[model samples]
Target: MLYQEKHRPQLHFTPKENWINDPNGLVYYEGEYHLFYQRNPHSNDHADMHWGHATSTDLYHWEEHGIALAPDELGTIFSGSAVVDKNNTSGLFESASGGLVAIFTHDGESQQQSIAYSEDKGRTWIKYEGNPVIPNTKIKDFRDPKVSWHEDSKKWVMALACGDHIQFYNSPNLIDWTYLSSFGKEYPSHIGVWECPDLLYLPVEGSSKKEWVLIVSINADGPNGGSAVYYFTGSFDGKVFHPNEKPEDALKWADAGKDFYAAVSWDNTEDTYWIGWMSNWQYAGVMPVSPWRSAMSLARKISLYEKDGNLLLKQTPVIADNRKEAASYQDVTIQPDTAESYAISDTAQIDLRISEASSSTKWGVKFVTDQEEVFQLAIDTQENTYTFYRTEGMIDFSEEFPEEIKGTLNGLDVQNLTAIVDRSSVELFLNNGLTVSTNLIYPQGTVTQLEVFAVNDVLQIDNVSWTQLKSIWN
Candidate 1:
């Protein structure tokens, strides 16, 4: 079983075959979650883009519904969003049953926005005859339209990524867009062209006032490297947005990890949730894909919290990984360059807290075999950084592969951390989601042991928690 399909993720969302990227059109209606993705049907490589559909009553087990939308005269279907038009906004509803609308990008001679609707659940789809609803003005990079209904404005708002910045469009109905404003001009990091854009309102963690969050995904030059999602918090008064952060700290990463990208929230009336593509495009095309290429990250509930006067995103996985606590440590003191081993599964979650985290402290946790380490997580009190690396045990090791990814917290005073491990992925929630590191790791063989060690000085590790996770397929 390991030789045939060792890297195939049993937990993440992978198709039966071929290529997949960017979780598109996430919506919740009638007690079911609808997920549309960007896929290529012909081969393992990316090409003829189409919208692949899937449905899940609970976020864990999914049922693929084949292609939802295909290439038309307008062009191939690209990344976009889905929403339930409760009041028949577009008037495309044949009756009360026909109100689910999907807004997506049509990539042809140029890029433009289009709409499609399904009256009977999401089994069937019909494209709007009036496509290219928001025509492109020859912008070199114009795509990925994320639309949401604004209650305060009493209209629909669209957040479209346009080159270096994002454009805001408003419409009374789902059609007939009126340009409002543009953002992201030298205010934040612009290492690559912004692709997916998501704008939503989140209430401050403890306060009553809610703030708007703008999320942008870039291909390269992430803080930790490769593809990542960066977000900005500000005020959106129906038309324009005002940045609430200091100029130097305007943009913040959604996750400090290298894999999480193209993340967008699910449209819900009660709770806010999001999902992301769990592989980096840097080496996506070359992964050892037999029947399938990539998968989506675990669905996570998105919430806002305020600490030290900054609004931070707290992500909690929808599906718990706790099969049982296999091993644990409490108030263990480690000497310099000393290591300790614990029993763990290939898929697991580890929670740790430090009693004293200071400049002279350096610690690392390794997933290894008899000979070498397969994966490693490091924390440096001196540098004030957290690092995750998949340098060894990779099936197809390449110099082209991304290097160790790193993220930072103020004063590097991280006391608590949660690490979720899967067959080919790892998600690190540092300081309770203040910092996140999600990485893809294809080990050469099964991981055999877990070792925790300290360097430079004696470190006190306390409040340790361990869980041998169950398979999501089960």
Candidate 2:
């Protein structure tokens, strides 16, 4: 009966109690995926930061291992990355196959970088005696070091968030570090401070080349006015990162939704698996959930691709194997200004494909409960935008919770889209995640109806299918 609390997510990762934000120390080792997060162990609110640990063999069923790193004299733990020192690089292990080393931010009189190691697969951790390996340089907003090994440079590279930009540094054995160069001078920034920075090399789709991607998460002034992650496609030398300038004037968001912040990728995985904190700072402390206050987004497989001579990132969910197909439809049509409704499971994955349609049309789908709770997604072809709103659900927890968020389609045809609806959230992946929107919704009644409608023009549904996702709590 544990985790059966109301509004709990059945398919995502959430701490059993207290509060969690900014996923940290994501790594895979010895057939287990380790997810450490910024946790407040004493309350359901954000405070007294610590590193909470969990492990999963399949990344779906997680087992909590309690607190892995506690608040010490140096300060409470902030956010950071973890790596496997297979060659005894830090010399912290007995065998050549070294253990796990975590590079994180210690938040005390300012924020500084620190490290700890675990020999027994992250079951326990020992703080480094020489803590604060990288001291703060009088910068008030410095934290969240994401470290990775540079095979070409033969050194460990750390991407640290320093005030307005990211600072690059190189270390030989995860201990001594030297500053390299800084980025974000020419990049656009919002009204908020930057927190987490991740540097990743992703293979460009349809090409043999791989490009470097620098991801930065900003708060308070996102496109939707909360926490959001945006990135720049660039080239990273051992000493510096040169961003490839894009033609667009606005910031390129990783997720075009109200949620999805503090995103980071797992180290030492076969493929790039990215996850983010599934709540916004604007209302995270006031979410109307019990026992658990926040949850993590579904681990998504991300890739880089080229479109119109511009390199972009795409995200696709790592679907579980236990999902069952519940319904199917094909070649359905709806007249202008009309809608068709269907009953659906509370937890389900809906996939739909639209045939080539007129550019003057406006169509959408709405999820509803018997009590009139509603969450809607709409595509305006004339405006070349897709918009979403969750204004009719149980959204009174925060005054800032009710708003509409939109993403530009840029004249792309309405080909396909997927909506993964859980107990308290919905993840909309449009055009194979070339554009994604993730939002949290709370309905006092179970969402039992889905309605498809078109406005001013006919809508064509090429194919549609529905699958009921199994609950992990079961």
Candidate 3:
């Protein structure tokens, strides 16, 4: 079969070939950004796990660097983290802080965390002979070690997903670990076992206070089902993570979408940044994109915000909003129950501002080809919710993809909407960073036009502009 290059993502990070799942061992070294992932290099199916490698100078354009950590006598490589060993803490290299270190999980008889050091940046790695740094316990599910430096305690802290709650462990030399505490046993969304947990400390805006953000990804149990990313804002006292006080059963989600999962931050970055596997565990390898299976969401700059006395994490695209406008229209008024269509790029960024919205107004946008309607993003004022419906448009390789994904927000306050469309994904952000919806869909046919329409009531569009994005693979 001929490869459908049009279905390949242009701006997102995808492996040169084969299957990849979780984003692993992300770190910033000097000027280059390193992204290691859970990969199967031999085929487009999930097996023979290895840490596939890629490097980017600016985190926008990536260079595939083959595999970094392969399977050994212990087992195949799994999800973990990487760090720059400053001050020669691990004593793996002669130099002080320039040495690179990668901490990962080896899956054998049981899941165990191990350490590997690189003398020449992150290109080469040597596993610590004293392997299984954090030996396996009696638990069944234990993996994904996300490590960071805790200055107050003067030790390295690891946030790992065990079963339900993420456990905290303190390490002195990245080898020996002391179990501190575990969180999230019977609280919040315990629909499934947690995976890919990241603990982050964020400074509050214009305040002396700081809060710790823990990102947890769940599968089979999300707001939209299949897979999703959820988060909590609190303070970690180097021993235990104390989630901020909230009403009973109030759980916060990172991105209210089905696609984004196993997200983590970049180590040694001056500012907080993140990226996620743009796939759901439900249909990850089944999408059949051929040479490659999945891609990563665009890197996002993360910040903290206050809403209803709760500190929430807001994500905005790290890449600048610079693109060539293919077509644009401003303050276009839509008559009652009418539709409008315009030409657009296969990959584009769309901005929409709809004002004079009423309780009866039903406004939405659709991605379509001349022969088929690919996807639809519709807002229902009466329900005070936004829905992304793909039942009529998607090519379902499996029985996992959801027919519709809906998110509820203050629809009255929703005046601005930005949609970032790649060949196979759509990430929708509303009113700055209040709510985001990331969905993956494979249009059965070509997608070459954009359409906006209204139902039941007349609506006036304050502004509408779209720009075709350049391919990062170029």
Per-candidate Cα lDDT values, in order, are: 0.82, 0.88, 0.83
TM-score of 3: 0.94
Q: Over the stretch 157-234, how does candidate 2's per-residue lDDT look in tens digits?
A: 999998788899999999999999998856666478888999999988778999999999999878888899998888
Runs in model 2 lying further than 4 Å from the true structure: 246-248, 357-360
RMSD of 3: 2.2
lDDT string for model 3 (1-474, tens) is 223375788878888778999999899987889999999999998899999989888777888887899999989999999988787788888776547889999988899999999887688799999999988997788999999889999999999998888999998889889999998885767678899999998866657777899889887788888889888888888998888755374567788788999999999998888899998888887885868889999898888877656676777875544576667787787766778888887778888887654333578899886567668998876777889986755556777684689886543456778888887888988766668889887776666788888887776787888889877755
Compute the lDDT for candidate 2.
0.88
The TM-score between candidate 1 and the true structure equals 0.94
The order by descending TM-score is 2, 3, 1
Candidate 2: clashing residue pairs, number? 0
Best by TM-score: 2
Clash totals for all models, in order? 1, 0, 0
Ranking by lDDT: 2, 3, 1
**What C-alpha lDDT, on a 0 to 100 scale, does residue 117 get in candidate 3?**
91
